[model samples]
Target: MLSPKLEVVITPNRIAVRNVGSGATATADAPFSCSHLLADDIDILEHAAQGAMKQVVGGGFLPSYPIVEVSTGGRPLHQVERKVIRDALANAGASKVHFAPSVTDVDEQADARAAYIAAAKRRR
Candidate 1:
């Protein structure tokens, strides 16, 4: 989980996240999903949160490993969601990125995300 210093907000159509101390920010917008399973706002928010975390982690800092892996609810992201995530990453200066094809355990994923956020903040 993110530390108390991190903040995440979700709305009907968008989500925003940031590290409170470092001023590093990330955001993702809701895009239409083809499958009902991925239609919830929470799903979109999850996608956005992943994007935000990638930004905080400076995915664009090094071109050698430009493809950051995003999570997609343990399955492949829908075509639309994939495009949205890819576009967001590109806008953040991550020239090339892809989503993880498999899911990480829940607690483990949370811990990993927190670590990434913390590490990114430290760099600032």
Candidate 2:
């Protein structure tokens, strides 16, 4: 079976996660400002990722490797910032990761995902 796709949106104060296939969604609030690139405390970002993953998974089973797409509220990320986000997702059991440009509407996320998948297929 194919692994599920997970989408995560990170902002300064919150992290929202959605399992695309299952439609299970969860959100985690940061104790302080926790933007992926600007935060002084990376641990808090990691913790928020963990907390959101736990909430989405709940008592249900989660695949060992899920395709994850993370959006940093439309801001571009530096190499270090990307690494920080990747590490957090890795801790949440993500194997494949994609970075999305900031999206405003919830519907835009689905469109972005479709475009990404199409581009990835062309690359292969």
The candidate that achieves the highest TM-score relative to the unseen native structure: 2
- lDDT (tens digit, per residue) of candidate 2 on 2-110: 5667899877768899988788899988853543343344678778877777666554435546788888677555566677777767866677878875632334366
Give the clash count for model 2.
1
Each prediction's whole-model lDDT (CA): 0.50, 0.71
The residue pairs found clashing in candidate 2 are: 74-102
Q: Lowest summed-lDDT stretch of 10 residues in model 1?
A: 1-10
Clashing pairs in 1: none
Q: How close is every model to the real structure, measured as TM-score?
A: 0.35, 0.66
Local accuracy of candidate 1 as per-residue lDDT tens digits, 2-84? 22233444333455555545677777677624444333443454456556655654553423223344555344344554565
Highest lDDT model number: 2
